[model samples]
Target: MVSRLGFLGVIARLFMWAFLLGLAVVVLYPLLWMVLNGFKTNAELFGNPFALPTGIDFGNYRDAWNRGVSGYLATSVLVTVTSTVATVFISAWAAYGLTRVDIPFNKVLTAVILGGLMLTPTVALVPLVRMFQSIGLYNSFWALLILYTAFRVPFTTFLIRAYMIDLPREVDEAAQIDGAGRWTAFWRIILPMCKPIITSTVLLHVLFAWNEYLFAMVFTNGSDVQTLPVGLTSLMSKHGTDFPVVFAGMVIAAVPVVFLFLFGQRYIVKGLADGVGK
Candidate 1:
């Protein structure tokens, strides 16, 4: 019976490893193929889709950069950075208030905020467009910034609030006993302690703002304000035959967020676990 149990454990381990290997291939192969294709010429790509490039070349990447990708990348960076800062800080403060402060109708306010998660972005699209246009914000940088920040705040607040709720009230009492005000306590102590979750929310918001398409497309017309998602579409349309350059543009767009997630994945896991677990 002991020998049989050991054999079953070995089988289970092998099965798990095989499953993981398959999953890795499924996730990584397309990315690898994309990068490899970025180095090939159009003829070479059409000639043999799966074959390796004849030689390493940077022309495709250069051409992609010169053909308005640089502008799009800059716009994406601006929108993503500004919106992320707005969303995370606002959410953090809202979370701090909801969890630590004794305000009137606290539960009602919490419900009203978290309830935003149920409000579909598509449902409000028409109204948002009309409002922005009336305010002369349509096809502008601030339009994307305001939209992304507003849409993301509720979810970000929910994540932070969940984590904040698990923290002991004694921390606040301690700060007060030492003659610290609420702002000082939050700025010095609570915010520092909430770093793990804050990192997670920041990463999440970056991903959203970077990859957002519908608003980016609808709100921005000129190449000056268009983001990667919209710019990539325009690239494909304008250079339909130059698939290599298109692939190169995609690789450029994906690299930052991919590297970011790889570096911060541990924080994301820890934050979500601690925030949601309690």
Candidate 2:
């Protein structure tokens, strides 16, 4: 019986490994193909889309950069960084207030904020456009910044608040006893304690702001302020026949977010585990 049990365990282990290997291929193969295609010539790509390139070529990448990818990349980076900072910090403060403060109608406020999660961006598009236009913010960098931050705050607050709720109240009491004000304690104590969730939310916001196409497309008309997602579309249209350059542009756009996820995946897992597990 022991030997039979051991044999079944081995079978289950083998099955798990096989499943993982298949999943990896499913995820990684397309990305690998895309990167490889970026190096191939247009003719080679059409001739054998599945095959590897015959020679390395940086020209396609250079052409992509020179065309307009550099500008798009810069815009994406600026918007992503600034908006991530704004979203995370604002959400953190809001989370602290909702979870730790003694304000009236706190529950109603929490409900109202979290209700934003149910609000669809598409449903509000026309109204938002008119509002931004009326405020003279349409087609501007600040427009994207405000929109990204505003849209992201609620979900970010939810995550941080969940994590904060699980924290011991003693931490706040200890800080208060030490002559620390609420703002000081939050900035120095609770905020630092919530680092894992903060990192996760920052990465999540970065991904959202980096790849956001609808708002970027609708809000910005010029290449100078358009982000990677919108700019990639423009690149494809302008270089419709230059498929390799388009592939290179895609690779360029994907690399940063990929590296970011790879680096912060641990924090993401931990933060969500701690936050949502509550």
Candidate 3:
């Protein structure tokens, strides 16, 4: 019986690992296929989608990059970088204030902020476009920047606030006694300690802002200001028959965010698991 139980345990563990591996492949296959096949010609792709390229035909990357991917990539990077930084800063400070301060109507204020999370962004598209246009920021980077920041703020605020609420109050008291004001206490004593979750939040938002397409498509019409995802699609239209070049453009847009997630995956897991239900 002992031998049989041990055998079953080993089998179970193997099965579990195999299952997870299968799931990873299922989820990752398309992205893997996209990147690898990106180097192959249409004829080559049709001949063997799964096989490695016969030779590295880097012209696809060269042509696409020279045409417009570089500009779009730069634009996307600019928008995502600015929006992510601003959002993180604003959300962190707002969360710290919400969780740490004992202001009147605090519950209501928090609820309103959190409520924004539940609201569908699609619902506000029309008014938002008009509003941005009225303010003369539409069809521009500032428009998309503001929209991205606003859309991401609520959830990030909630995430930071949830973690902040669970953080030990003793730290705050000690900071105060040591002559740190509210802002200083948060900056010096608390923010540093929340690095795991904050990093996770930044990564999450970076991915969001990077991949964001609808707003980018809607807000920025010109190739001069379009983001990667939007610009990649536009590249597809212009190079529809050139599957390799289109795929190459897609790969360029996707690689950074993919690597970013993979590298910071541990932080993401720890952030979500940390202080959860505490």
Candidate 4:
């Protein structure tokens, strides 16, 4: 009976490996195809989409970069980085307050913050556009930054608050007993202890603010404040026939996000698991 059970376990393991192998191939092939096709000319690409490029072509990348990708990249970096910082900072503080404080109407405030999660961006687009324009923020980098930060704060606050709520209350009490003020304890102790959740929140904000399209499209004009997604669309439209250059531009735009995920993936998984599971 034991031998039969072992045999079944081995078969299950093999089947699992095969399934994962196929899944990996399915996920990776499109990315590999895009990168490889980026090296092929229009003739080469249309002639044989599946075939490897005859030679590596740096010219496509160079041309793609020259054609305003550089500017778009800079703008995306600025908006993503700034917005992520602002979102995480503001959200972290709010989370700390709601979880740790005994303020009057704290429950009402918590409900209000969580209520933001129900809002879909499209519902508020017209009003947001009008408000930003009235405030002279339309078609500017600040428009995207403010919009991204505002939209992201509520969810981020919730995540951090979850993790914070699960944290040991003894730590905060001990800090207070030792003469540490709330601000000092938050900055010096609580924030450090909340590193895992903070990392998760930062990565989430980065991914959202980096790849977001609708706000990037609506909030900024294409000239100076356009982000990578909108920029990529414009690139495609302008060089509609230049598949190689467009592919190169896409690969460039994707590289940063891929690298970020690879580096922080461990922290992201751990933080989210701890924050959500407990």
Q: How close is candidate 4 to the true structure, as a TM-score?
A: 0.96
The ten-residue window of minimal lDDT in model 3 covers 233-242
> How do all the candidates rank in terms of lDDT, highest first?
1, 2, 4, 3
Compute the lDDT of residue 219 as modeled in candidate 1: 81
What lDDT tens digits, residue by residue, belong to model 3 across residues 78-191? 998999999999999999989888899999999999899988878999999889889888889899889899988999998888888888899988988889998899888889
lDDT per model vs. reference = 0.94, 0.93, 0.88, 0.92
Tens-digit lDDT string for candidate 4 (126-179): 999999999999999999989999989999999999999988999999999999
lDDT of each residue in 1-278, candidate 2, tens digit only: 99999999999999999999999999999999999999999899999999999999899999999999999999999999999999999999999999999999999999999999999899989999999999999999999999999999999999999999999999999998899999999999999999889989998999899999999989899988999999987766643578899899999999999999999899999989988886
- The better candidate by lDDT, 1 or 3, is 1
**What are the per-model numbers of colliding residue pairs?**
0, 0, 0, 0
| TM agreement with the true structure for every prediction | 0.97, 0.96, 0.93, 0.96
- Runs of candidate 3 with Cα error greater than 4 angstroms are 47-51, 238-240
* Candidate number with the higher lDDT (3 or 4): 4
Models, CA RMSD each: 1.2, 1.3, 1.8, 1.3
